[model samples]
Target: MNENRHSVIVIVIIIVGVILLSKLFMIQVVDDSFLRRAERNAVQRIIDYPYRGLISDRNSELLVYNNPVFDLMVIPQEFSIKDTAKFCDIFQIEKQKLIERYTAAKKYSWVKPSPLIKQISTTDFAKIQDYLIDYPGLFVMTRSVRAYPDSIAASALGYIAEIIPRQMERDSLHYYNQGDYIGHSGLESYYEKILRGKKGAKYKMVNVRGVDKGSFKNGTLDTASVAGLNLQSTIDMQLQQYGEKLMKGKRGSVVAIEPKTGEILSIISAPVYDPNLLAGAAYSKNYNILLSDTTKPLFIRPIQAKYPPGSIFKVVQSLIGLQWGTLTPNTTYACNKALVACHNHPSPVNLFGAIRNSCNPYYYQAFRQMINQEISSNTYTDTQIGLDKWHEAVEKFGLGHELGVDLPYENSGSVPSSSLYDRIYGKGRWKYSTIYSLSIGQGEMEVTPLQMANLAAIFANKGYYYTPHLIKAINGDPGKIPEEYTTKHDVGVAAHHFDMVQNAMAEALYGTAMRAIIKDITIAGKTGTAQNPHGEDHSVFIAFAPKEDPKIAIAVYVENAGWGGRAAASTASLMIEKYLRGHIERPALEEYVLVGDFGD
Candidate 1:
């Protein structure tokens, strides 16, 4: 019995030894999980950030370029400082600031690299070369910062800043890191994917001191980061600069579009600061200043500001009437008490004359006829059908909706639908008289400067329009734009109907908008004094130059500017002259535009 017991014990010991050896072999050879974890500390990943895309005007004039910059990175697990004072002096940063940064980086991650200082100056960076090796896990990473050459078009170009936690949560692709930068608004945000190139990384073998030993696996595992694709913007730099100058000291917006392509020529929202104000090391400081300013310079008015389009929308009324067969170029409506008081003009003007004269009663009567017109024998009263037709026709002109411009944060200016009226005035309680003010572009309608400019493009095209977009081409690929941008959006109105209106607008440049006329250039334009319930009226104008073969379509809105005939028209005229003639011949007109305080 003793011998048998000893034999069982010996067999048990042999079985235990075999199990331990097999487990060890599997962990060391078959399962590489432990090996990878061990290599994690030795083989450090160096992120090779690609150069951000370049931006240029349609004419190939460089608007934004990349300048070499440096960010000081630190790994919390490996970070150690021997002399805090020396570090501060070398980087020219406050000691407290360094401590704060170090604490933040440590809190964020222990193993990953975090930026301790961003956008260090060249002189300071050069001085730190000898001292940098002293601090382990502290090194400079080469990157590029955006540099605005012209310092104009701040709102259009937008600004880039560090990505926040919210962005990380929203980014399902998991591309960005904590300290990475991203486009916050404007064209930057619109083309972020196309403009932001793919990020690549290099695996490098490093010593315990964080000193680079050599490339891991001889760089076979490394990836080369490609530079971001360049953007060729539709904006004309000369026109943009001139528009900004014209808009100085005024609270307003100016937008110009190419009639044929719907490409934006120049878009300005004032009072604008230099784009440089939002770039480089002082970005955070200047950003706070801009945020605190009362003027709201950050607002992109061209596609965001919603206001009553005023008499500029009268052209749309005429087109709708023409579509309904309720009005014609010769259609006359007598000026009567049906419409409210208005600025003096010839009474009972024709369709063309009503626009040229801006007669309020004519528009009111015109809108009445349009809404009263029978649709399959449906009466105007106790019915939203006719009014709904009017709404559909108007929306087709790109009003009451975003025109899909290639920029972010566009406001879809409201166009009260028939259902909206059903809610507001009760299903059938509304009538033409109930919304008479709408005929003159007042009541429930609102339009962005971009939408208004698109209206001009529609008229310039005599019915159809391409979606207004800031990017003319991407990566120099002209045909690579969105399908909708290249597609023509026909308003479903006949082209011939626009001729009379164009002729009338041409006549107006010699009449109410006399100041809008350029030397030997017959521009077609309409002036609007959009009523403001709060304060003074807003000056608004929509126009296209050289009436015959239209090139540029523009819209201008000057807040609290009494008459569109002055402020809006003058600005439009100067912009047209500058773009077409390459210079301004009307010095007196330029003086009026620059020194005018119509808004005040």
Candidate 2:
């Protein structure tokens, strides 16, 4: 019995030895992962960051470029310094801040590298390089920060910021790191994927002192990073600069488009700061100030702020009426102030005369004809049917919906439909009399400055418009644009109906908008004074130059600037003269706009 038990024990020992030997062979010879893990102390992986794309205007003038910056990285396991005070002094960082950063880094990863300090300028980095040797785990990584040369178009150019924890987790491809920068707004955010190039990797050998010896395998395993593709924007920098200049000290926005191609030549939001303020190391400090300011300089008013279209919308009313066969060019209505108040003008005028004089009663009576078409025996049902039809026609003009501009977060301004009225006033309860405020572009009707600019382009084309976009090309190739920008949208209005309206707008300059007339340029335009219950009226103007074959279409909205004939019209005229003539011949008009002094 004793001999048999000893034999069983011997067999069990032999089986266990065989299993251990097989496992050792599998780990040592079959897989190199364990060996690679062992080499982590001596080897370091480095990220090769690609240069961000450049941005230039239609004139080939540089708008945005990059400047080299440095980030200080730390591996928590190897991070140890005998003199913490001296390190803080070199970096100008507080002792408590340093401790917090180090603790955060340690929590992130003991083995992996994390950012200790970010966006140190080249000059600042140079001052502290010699002292870096005293810290074992700390290393320098080179990257670039955005630089705006001309310092114009702050709202359009946008800004970039570091990737946050949530953003890193959402990175499906695992591209961004903790300290990496990404575009935050405007064109930057809209074209982020196209503007951010692919990243590469480098493996290097490091001594115990953290000194770089050489490439890990003579760069055989290293990959090359590709620079991002450059963007050729549609903006004319000179025109954009001039527009911003004219908007100085004013609270509003300006948008200009090429009537033929739908390319945006200039887009300006006033109360703009130097774009450079948001770049480099000063981003957080300056951003907080801009955010807290009561004036709200950060607001991108062109696509975001919605307001009543006011008298400028009368042009659309006439077109819709003409298309639906509710009114005609020869339709006449008396300038009866009882329907709505109007300035002194000829009474009982035709369409052309009414448009030139901006006769409010004519539009009121014309709108009545449209909404009270006698489609149903019940007055309420007939009003509903007529309003639904009108709403459908208005939607074709790109009102009440996003125009799909190549920018992030564009607001879809409201256009009241029959259903919206139903929600407010209950079904079958409201009619033309309750909603007549829409006739003169008031009440629930709203539009963005960008949409208004597009309206001007539609009128310039006589019945159609292309989608407005800022990007003209990618990597110098204009043919790579999206199909949407190239598509022509017809407003469903007959082309002939525009002739009378165009003729009237040209004559309008000689009447209410006389200040908008430019020398040698026959401009077709309409002025608007949008009423504000909380403050003064907003000045608004829309125009296209050389009424015969329009080249540029524009919209200007100045808040609390009184009559459109003053601030808005004058500014639009100066912009037209500058863009068309290449110089401003009327310095007196330019000075008047700059002064911005309209008596209360």
Candidate 3:
């Protein structure tokens, strides 16, 4: 009985030994959890972020630059701090804030590193970095925040901020991280790819205490970060600042373009905040405040605000009428109030006189002639045929559609078409008289300030215009500018026709827009008081300087201001004189615009 018991005990021991060996084999080689854990403890991946591109004006004036900042990161599984009070004192954060940040990091991933506190400035980081060594699982990553020295062009230059989840999910290449900063509007957003350089990576070795020893593999596997390409924008900083100063306390916008190059010289939206206000720690708070404001300080009025073209649109009508042979230089009409209300201008005026006086009835009759060409026997069909041709002619001038300006969210101002009329007043039911409101730049017509500036540019160019753009050169190379901006877009109007129209516009300055006249400077301009049933009329003006050799083309719009001559014309003339002469000879006029008071 003793021998049988010994044999049974030996068999039991063998069975237990086999099971133990098998389990040891599985733990040692079959499962990868142990290997992964070992690698995690030995190696840490580090991101080498590149410096964002610097931005400069056309004259090499630095507009945007990067300032060094640091982000505190923590690996939640290894994070621990015994002296909470000391930690709070060093980082300038509350104890509850630290706890909340740690909890969030834990929820993100226990092993992965997440930002505990972001965008600590150089001064702040210097004070707290030494104490970070006392806390395990904590290190800093270098980053940059954009700084604007002049603090101008807030809407045009734009601002950058932390990437959103939707943007991250849309990134197919996974280039951006949760903490990455990206451009959110204007030129910054438009040139995001070129401005954000390529990122580099390194494998770092760490001790059991989570102390970074050095680069892994003797830095053989490390990749160097490449600095982003700097931009040479066409913005004239001095002119931009001047325009902004002139637009203060006024609800309007001013846009200026170099007629020869289509390079944007100045773009200003009134009630602009400093670009620095949207950078770094104050972004969210300031953005929320701006968003809630009634006047919409955040609105980019130059390209985004849609306003009725007003009488300035009559210039477009003259060109279209001249092109289609519907009207002539000597075509005459009376200032008849029976057709449309007139402001007591002289009667029996020719095209030049009508443009000078801005007669309502003259354009009213001219549009009737253009829209009733009798192409079809039916009056409605004939009007549609004529209107379709007119619409086609208008679109060629870059109206009724986005001008493709190198900015985000440009408003495509509406142009009334037969299709639009069809949608509104059924297809074969409307006639020329029914839509006579379109004659004097009213009705369904609308335009942005940028478009109006380009219109001025077109008149300056005589028949064609280069697409208006902000970027004159890329990385100091003008040849690198997009071909579309350089290509001439012919508005399909006869070049010689511009001479008559240009002459008439020049005459207008002397007649109606007398406030726009400059000493020894020949300016061709037109003014419009856009009727607004809501309140006072919107003042409008479009002009190009030195009629012989045009240099700058500009458009100005002031909302609820009285006559176009008093406000818009005066403001535009000041901008013109400031740009051409390099100083304002009319300080009184400048002060007048600055005061922003248009009397009743």
Q: Using TM-score, give the best candidate's number.
A: 2
Candidate lDDT values, in order = 0.86, 0.90, 0.88
Q: Highest lDDT: give the candidate number.
A: 2
lDDT of 3 by residue, 1-600 (tens): 999999999999999999999989998989889977887678887889999899999999999999888889998878888888988988998899899999999998776678899889888887987888788788788889899999999888988999998878888998998788998898889998889999999888877655667878798989989988898888999899898888887888899999988999999998877899888776889999999988888899999998888888888888889888989988999888998988877789988888888888999999988989878899999999988888898888888899888889899998898999899989898898888988988999888999999999999999888889999777888898778899989999999989988888999988778889998999999998877888988899999999999999999999889789989999899888988988988888887888888782
- Tens-digit lDDT track for model 2 on 87-198? 8899878899789999998898776778888889999998999988887788888989999999998888888898878778878988887677998898887888888888
Model 1 weakest 10-residue run by lDDT: 374-383
Candidate 2 residue spans exceeding 4 A from truth? 1-15, 36-43, 165-170, 205-214
Candidate 1 lDDT over 3-47, as tens digits, reads 999999999999999999999999999999999887787798888
The 10-residue segment with the lowest total lDDT in model 2: 204-213
Which residue pairs in model 1 clash with each other?
A: none
How well does candidate 1 score on lDDT at residue 320? Answer: 78
C-alpha TM-scores of all predictions: 0.95, 0.95, 0.92
User: Which candidate, 1 or 2, would have the higher lDDT against the true structure?
Assistant: 2
